[model samples]
Target: MNTIGHTIKAARERRNLTKEELAQKLRVGTHTVEKYESGEQIPSNQTILKLSTVLDIPTSELLKKQNI
Candidate 1:
């Protein structure tokens, strides 16, 4: 899984939101939410923050972890 998948999963769990509910809030298709969770696609920075806000996660946590 990709960074987005991990982040999405964690955030969703934190907010107790299902994929369908997240999709509704994002106003995107459920498939889109699935894709993000499955690492099939990565959203832009703006969308990432929007997702973090909606999911109540920090942007850093939602972003890929940097290698030391």
Candidate 2:
């Protein structure tokens, strides 16, 4: 099952961006990116919107959830 974090990490990797690079684009720190990717945190709606734009993915993709 894919968590939102997994989806985000996959999208980021598809864009060939490192955690630091994605953080820089999102105006967040590298640790924050790690947290997001590790499913230790969730981003705000505003940040999600920014991520959609930066990652060239739909917001729906970021909002997807696992059945569990």
Candidate 3:
């Protein structure tokens, strides 16, 4: 299964959003977003909720295991 980082990266790309743009929306640093996409860091529950809203995807979808 694809990791959460890959899922987040794919979702962000599908929405045509840059890491900086998403970071702005999430009120976090660009590096933090980069870490998230790289699987070097995992977002907190609150951040996950924010990501779902920002990405316009369901939280369950974001949390779901993806076939790699």
Model 3 compared with the native: what TM-score?
0.89
The digit string of per-residue lDDT tens for model 2 on 8-66 reads 99999999999999999999999999998998898888999999999999989898884
Extract clashing residue pairs from model 3. Answer: none
Full-model lDDT, candidate 2? 0.92
lDDT score, residue 30, model 2? Answer: 99
Instruction: List where candidate 3 sits over 4 angstroms from the true fold.
Output: 66-68
- Give the TM-score of each candidate: 0.83, 0.93, 0.89
lDDT of each model, Cα atoms only?
A: 0.80, 0.92, 0.90
Candidate 1 similarity to native, TM-score: 0.83
Error of 3 at 58 (Å): 1.1
Candidate 3 lDDT for residue 45: 89
Model 3 lDDT, full chain set: 0.90
Task: Return model 1's CA RMSD, one decimal.
Answer: 2.8
Q: lDDT at 66 for candidate 3?
A: 41
Q: What is the lDDT for 33 in model 1?
A: 88
